[model samples]
Structure formats: structure tokens, C-alpha cells
Target: MFGGSDIKIDVKKPVYELIVEHILTNYNFLHKQVSHHVDVEYSAVLTGLALGDGRIHSAFKRARISDENAGEIAKKLMDTNIVRLLKSRKQFTSWVDDERVSDKLLFTTPFMRFWFAFVAPIFKGIKEGNYDEFNQRYENKIAEFREAVFKELSNELVKISFAEEKVVETGAYWDREVELDIFAKTASKKVIVGTCRYTNSKLKKSEIAKLEELANRAKIKADVFVIVAKRGFSSELKSLKSEDIRLFTLKSFKSLL
Candidate 1:
């Protein structure tokens, strides 16, 4: 039973601030040693991590920038071309009204995707290392890593669900007593709660029951239930039939995209 209040997670620092400080300091230190401008692709990757996962305060703590212009500062860093842009006009034709900005800017980049998926977790592990039993405890949690990846792709998932007329609002949610991995709201005020399970094992009925209970108790409007699994549902879950319940495998999810 994972209660929202029981999850003792810390607010992490933004990766962009760290990258900026790293560039400034290293550029000064190695100005005579290196001759290349720090790559924009790499900076973008770091900024994505900072903006998405790193704590806002942490970025300020590292750089001491006032809150009034943090967004401007971040944009300036992003515009420096240290990080490569990934989205193009052709990729987002249906989503954007301004083609000029679409061509000049990217919605996202692979490096940021990679950092959010892999580097962030690894960094945490290294930071919390225990030399007494480092090797034994340092093994990565593959399931968690995969869940993070799914979180990064949540925007796309929401778009797919919307096209299917199954979702209205898609965003992550967590509070003092509860946390939903993916929350989709419908126009009728019905809520579609989903979790991304990235493993070989099938989803159990107990998990579905848990989701249902959470949805029922959530301090938000909800009417539908959804479970998105990578491996598929268990026999017990497959047998479930309810008007509010819906099941989707990863393949089915991708097909929508």
C-alpha cells in the first residue's frame, strides 16, 4: 500500500542550472584547454532534466538567480544552441498554429528524453551510494527506469487517448495522501486513471482494485478506469468486465499514436 504521504521523495535540483554553472566554471577553467562551444544538444538535454525533474529551488540555489526572471534566463540558456532542438514543423503540423516558431524551436529533444529516462536515476544512485555495500545495492531498478520513460512520453499518450475520445485532460498528479501516475479526465467529468507497468509480469486484479479505490477516493471528478500495461493483463484481470473499466496494452497504445 503506497500512500501519497508515505512517499518521501525530495525535490530535486534542475539539471539546467547545474549545466549552466558547469559551463561557466569549466569554460573559465578550461578556456585555454578547450576550443569548442559547449554543444547545444548537450545543454538542451541537461535543461530538460532540470526543468522537468529537478527542483526549481535547487536551480536557484546553485546559481542565485532571482525568481522574477528565471524563465527568461532559462530561455536564454536554451537559445544559446548548446542543446539541439528536436521538433520540426513537419512533425507538429496538426498541433501548432504558428509554423515559423515551430520551425525555429523544438518541442523536445532526444538528449533530454535520455536524461529523464536514464541519467537522472543513475545520478541519484551515485549520490546516495553506500561504500559499505555499493556494488550489491547499485543495481538499477529496470521497472522504475521504464516507468520514468513512460512519464516522458505521457504527452503523446494523452494525445492518443484524446483521439480515441477516451481522455479530456492528461497530466501527472500527486498530493499529500495520494498520487496518480497518469490522470486523464473526460468531458463528462469522468476521470480515467492509468498506470504504466513496464515489465514482463501480467497485471493482477489486486492492482486494478487498488486503482479503483484510489479513483473513487481521489479529490477530483472521475468516472472511468484505465490501465496501460506493457506486458498485458493477468487472467484474473482479463476476466474483469465493467462499464467503467478499460484495459490497454502498450501495443494498443502505440497503434493509437
Candidate 2:
């Protein structure tokens, strides 16, 4: 959480607790990094982006700020490299309305995302040495937050796994009709669509079925279908692994190292 640090880590302590002690509780450090760049208005919009779906419309609404104000702040945030706009991969068609499809805002770094998501809103409480709200929010939302991080990392793994095929682009694909967790196009124009499940249960063949259904719904012909899970897969899913189908476990991340 502190980036590169010489501080010794205690193996027995929970990571969440350590983050609280070292990062969240230290207002002076946070202020030094953020004060020059953002004010309360900027911070509120950032917190909205972190807490909500990252859509510009949704973020503005969540922040209870006007679209004009949010738009300006979002641009400033992007200019400072605090966040980036992620456009949807849905193919533009005459029939599909572009204005209806909203672009998402993503933090440039995981630590900033974590800070806005968990620490910024409840900063007053933390500043006062009260951690009940922070702890409860962390306990409830950590899995969801980690799942997003896992999906981003899985994009890198996909590029590595497809070593023979150069992946030209990779990101989440979303439209008004459907949302796909992983979407990539190889240099040969082959479409690869997949999903990530950061859960303890083993993935089943039904996961593939769901992915295919989403692809069909989105009118995307996937040349490859991949499933990334926290645990391993069921025997039924394992049986179908082939050149067209791929499965990855959490252990696959070691290759990234």
C-alpha cells in the first residue's frame, strides 16, 4: 500500500488492518499527495467514481453534482493522470445509439482507487481515530474491489497466454444489452471473450455457457472463450478445454512475475 517500502511486514496481521495503520490513518501524508491536486469537489467526484460503476452519468449522479461540474472535474482528473476514460468495445452500428452508451472512468493506480473507495468518504471518522465505519465498509466491499483488480490483471495474463497471437487490444466490453468482463482482439482480428470469477467455488461448464450466451446476445463471434477463476474448475469444465477454450486459475498469475 505504501509502494516501495523497507518496513517489515508482520505475517500474522490482516492486510486490511495494516493498510489502515500505515496509509488510511495518516492524513498528513495523504494531504501532501492530494491537496495540491484536488479540492472537496474533486474528491467527491472521485469517491463517486470509485464507489459507483465509473460511468460518467452515474458518477455525477452519485456525487450529487451537476453534469457541467462533473465533466470539468473529470477532465482535470484525466489531465493529472488520476483517472482515465474507458470506452466500450461494442462495435458502432447505425442501429446502436452512441449517446446512450456511457464511457467509464478508471483510476490510474490501484492505491488511489482504494483510497477513494474506502478512505476518502469516511476520512472524517478516520481522522478522529474512529474506524468502525471503515472496517465495516472494507469487510463488505473488499471482495468486490479485489475482483475488479483481478480482472485487470487477467488482461495481462491473456496477453501472455496468447503468445503466438499478438493481442492488439484488451478491456471490459459493455453495452446497453450486455456486459462482458474480458474482451480482446488479436492482430489477426480474432475476437476473444471471457469472464473472471473471484470466488472460492470451482467453476462449472455453465460458466462457459453463460459466456457464449452473452457473446451471442452482443452479436460478437468469439474465436476464443476463456474463464479465469480464483479456484480451479469443475471436471466438466476441464473436459472442454481446448484450442478454442481456455481456463486459468489464480496460480496462473505467477507467470506475470
Q: For this target, which candidate reaches the highest lDDT against the unseen true structure? A: 2
Q: Which stretches of candidate 2 lie over 4 Å from their true place?
A: 1-13, 91-99
Residue 130 error, candidate 1, Å: 22
For model 2, state the Cα shift of residue 254 in Å. Answer: 0.8
lDDT of 2 by residue, 35-131 (tens): 6656666888888887776888888887787877766777888998878999887752123554467789998877778878898888888888888
Q: Judging by TM-score against the true structure, name the best candidate.
A: 2
lDDT of 1 by residue, 9-115 (tens): 23364543443333222333433322143343334334334344333333444445566765555465457543333232122112323323211222244333333
What local distance difference test score does each model get? 0.48, 0.83
CA lDDT, candidate 1, residue 110:
39
Query: Residue 45 error for model 1, in Å?
Result: 11
Model 1: ten consecutive residues of lowest lDDT: 1-10
Q: Global lDDT for candidate 2?
A: 0.83
